[model samples]
Target: MKVLVVGSGGREHALLWKAAQSPLVTALYAAPGNPGMEALAERVPWDGDLEALAEFAEREGIDLTLVGPEAPLVEGIADRFLERGLLVFGPTQRAAMIEGSKAFAKTLMERYGIPTARYRTFRDPILALEYLEEVGAPVVVKDSGLAAGKGVTVAFDLHQAKQAVANILNRAEGGEVVIEEYLEGVEATVLALTDGKSILPLIPSQDHKRLLDGDQGPMTGGMGAVAPFPMDEATQKQVEEGILKPLIQGLRAEGVLYRGVVYAGLMLTREGPKVLEFNARFGDPEAQAVLPLLESDLVELALRVAEGRLEGARPVWKPMAAAAIVLASPGYPEAPRKGIPLRIPEPPEGVLVFHAGTRLGPQGLETSGGRVLNVVGLGKDLEEALGRAYAFIPQIGFPGAIYRKDIGKKALRR
Candidate 1:
């Protein structure tokens, strides 16, 4: 089977790597893939152009097309490919609104009795500020639309919270902002593959979103992540039964046959697992950490979902723990300096580098974005995985590269 993976990031790179390992995969291609992915698949220059991607897939006789990002999915690429009788793995545009629009997702959760934070959406700055004053401090301000994963701000004080609201309501990029009651708890990400009926949950993973070490500074895409989190079996079951089941059933009842990956960003509060947000596709650093432990054939599973036969497929996973630490440019989640030369020494036996913001320059590999590469390490436990992950940081050469020294400290303490 010839496979075409879309997008250009660490997540896409990991997907490409996994797809290449499939024996059924005869040919592999990545559309506008990064430098790391070029080594795994035949790199193409289409950066998720719906029509061009569809045309290329049909012309190249690609057996399956897997989308890795949410932008193209929201642009109706899946529907376009399906119109041409091509097997595309992603949700339709209408269904993708669950991730595309924050307000829409929050409304869905409320209407379906899905537990989440108390939130209100506002478009006017004056009205929003008034609401903010009433709501008080220690809140979260989120951009209603995608901000490249840097839109959400968790303010610890009232002054910071008001500024966050002002930044979103007054900025040119920000339109409507969603202010929600802050829920303090352990944050975890649960991603599952669904056929609009049966949901197959992957191992739960936790991501460090803070830009600085010790979970300080502004929120970023994700600094690092660790899989097989310390959640008890009972808590995991509660999340599945209370959150995932209701979400899946609700979407189905709404006439949205949700197929593809569903990412539930959960805040494991004392009450239970309350969803913070929903991502239509896999999480970034979370994918970097989780995919390495998947023991099943990615190509077969994706094809089954595209064919609407996921009920017959059972995904398998490794018992080992996996951790991914992201290496970022000088200043991230803010002003990031680019064009810094990066020298990555030969990886250790079990470590893999999934490039995020990098390009093959004339000199060598250089920093191309805020987050550079995700260094992944696998081990029998979290400690062993984290040990291997942090060992390679010094070997990777990049000027002003910042990384969270304590990526999985929380889980380790638990």
Candidate 2:
């Protein structure tokens, strides 16, 4: 079967890598894929035009189309392909509102008794500031619309919280903001495959969102990630029963035919695991870290899910830990310096480099976006995985390259 994976980032690169390993895949292509994926799959130019993408898929006899990024999913890429009777993995536009609109997700959680943070939505900045004073500090301020994972700010003080509100509301087109009570605990990600009925949970992973080491600085798409998060069995069970199960039922009741990965960003608080957010697709660095552990043929699994036949898919995963450390361009999550030449020495035996934002330059590969590459490492355990990843950091050289020294420090201490 021929397949086309959408998007251009490290996540797409990982998906491309996984799909290439499937013997069932006869031909593979990535729409607007990065330089790293070019080695494995044929790259097709996609200008975010859904109609054109569908046309290309039809013309190329692509058996299945997998979406990698949230933008197109939120815009109804899956719905468009399904309308054409084409097999596509990812949620429809209405189903994607769980990630596209924080307010919508919060309302759904509230209506369905899903575990989540207490939150209120606001369209007016003044009303939002008023609530800020009422709620006090240490609250999370989030843009109701997508902001590339930087939309939410965990403000420690009233001033910072208010500033976040103003920043999100002051956008040219204007947008609503959601302010939720701060839940104290370690954060982890739970990704699951669902066919609008049966839900299959994947290994839990933790993502370090801060740009600097020691969890200091602003939030980025993700600085790095580690799979098989150190979560007690009790906490895992609570998430499965109270979050993932309820979420699937809720979407079904809402008349949404969701068929794809449902990512629940959870804060494992003392009260239990509370969802922080929901993503319509796989997490970025999380995908880089987790896909390597998947022992099943991804093409077959994706096809089954897309066709709403995941009941007996029986997906399998390796019993090993994986870590992905992101290497970013200078000034990432703010003003990034681009076009700098990047020097990545040949990866050590167990390391795989997935490009996030890069391009072939006159000198060599150069940084094209904030986050440039994801260096993934696999080992018998988390520590070994991290050690394998960290050893290659020094070998990679690029002007103004920035990366966190401690990628999986949270799990390491555990």
Candidate 3:
């Protein structure tokens, strides 16, 4: 079967890699794919143009079209393809509001009694500041709309918290912002495949969101992540029951068939697993970490969901731990300096590099964006995996490249 994977990032690269292993796959294509994905699939230059993509798929007789980024999904690409009687693996535009609009998601969660942080939405700067002052320090400020994973700011002090609110509200177009009560706890990413019903959970993983070492600095897309996170069986069960199930049922009741990956960013607070946010598709670094441990056929599973036959198509996972550490250009989460040449040496055993913001230039790989390559390592445990991940970093040298030193430090302390 021929397939077209959309977007150009580490997540798309990983998807292309996994889908290529399927025996049924005959041809694979990536739209605007990065240099790393060039080896895995044929690279196309389309920037996720819905009509153009659909036309290309039809002309090429593509069997399935897999979306990679949130932009195309938010633009209702799935709905358009479905209208053309094409098979697509993503939720509809209406279903995508779970991630597109934070206010909408919060309302849904409240309606369903799903566990989450207390939050208030505001479009007015003055009212927002008043609420922030009332709520006190250590709150999270989030852009209601998509901001390329850099919109959410977890402020630790009153001054920073107020500034975050001001920055978001004072923007030119002034998008709605959410001020959330910060819940202290370990965070985990749980991605599941569903046909708007029968949910099949993937391996749980934790991501480090801070930009610097020792969990310092501002939030970023993700610095690193580890799969098969050390969550007690009881806590995992609580997340499934208290968070995932209610969410699925609520979406179903709302007549929204979410037939794709449901990514729940949860905080394992003392009260239980409270959702931080809901992403309609897979997480970036989390996808980089989790997909390596998946032993099941991803293409088959995705096809089942697209065909609405996911009842008996549970995915299998390996027992090993997989870690992904992201290497970023200088000044990430702010002014990132690009165009620096990168020198990546031979990867150590059990290590792989998935490119994110890189291009194969005349001089070799060059930094192209804030987050660059995702260096992945697999081992028996988190520490072993982290060691393998770090061992590859020094080999791949780039000027002013930054990464968190404490990739899996939380799991180590636990």
What does the lDDT come to for candidate 2? 0.91
The prediction achieving the highest TM-score against the true structure is 2
Give candidate 1 misplaced runs (Cα > 4 Å): 172-174
**Whole-model lDDT per candidate:** 0.88, 0.91, 0.88
Candidate 3 residues lying further than 4 Å off, grouped into runs, are none
Candidates in order, TM-scores: namely 0.97, 0.98, 0.97
What's the C-alpha lDDT at position 120 in model 1?
Answer: 97
Candidate 3 structure quality by residue, lDDT tens digits, 288-400? 99999999989999999999999977677887898899999988878887788988887878998989999877788898899998999999888888889988788888878
Candidate that scores best on lDDT: 2
Lowest lDDT 10-residue stretch of candidate 3: 312-321
Candidate 2 structure quality by residue, lDDT tens digits, 1-414: 999999999999999999999999889899999888888889999899998998889888889999999999999898888888889989999999999999999999999999898899999999999999999989999999988999989999999999999998887899999999999989999999888877888889999999998899998999999998888888888888899888889888988878999999999888888999999999998999999999998888888888888887677889889999998988888999889988888898879999989999898789899999999989999999999998988888876678898988889888
Task: Write down the TM-score for model 3.
Answer: 0.97
**Residue-by-residue lDDT tens digits, candidate 1, 1-414:** 999999889999999999999999999999989888876889899855689989999999999998999898888998999899999888888778888889899999999898999999998988888888898888899988877678898877878877877877887765888999999889999998887887778899999998988888888999999998888899889878888878889988898888888899999999998999998898999999999999999989888888888886777889889999999988786878788999988899778889999988889889888999999989999888888889987898887888989989898888
As for candidate 2, its clashing pairs are none
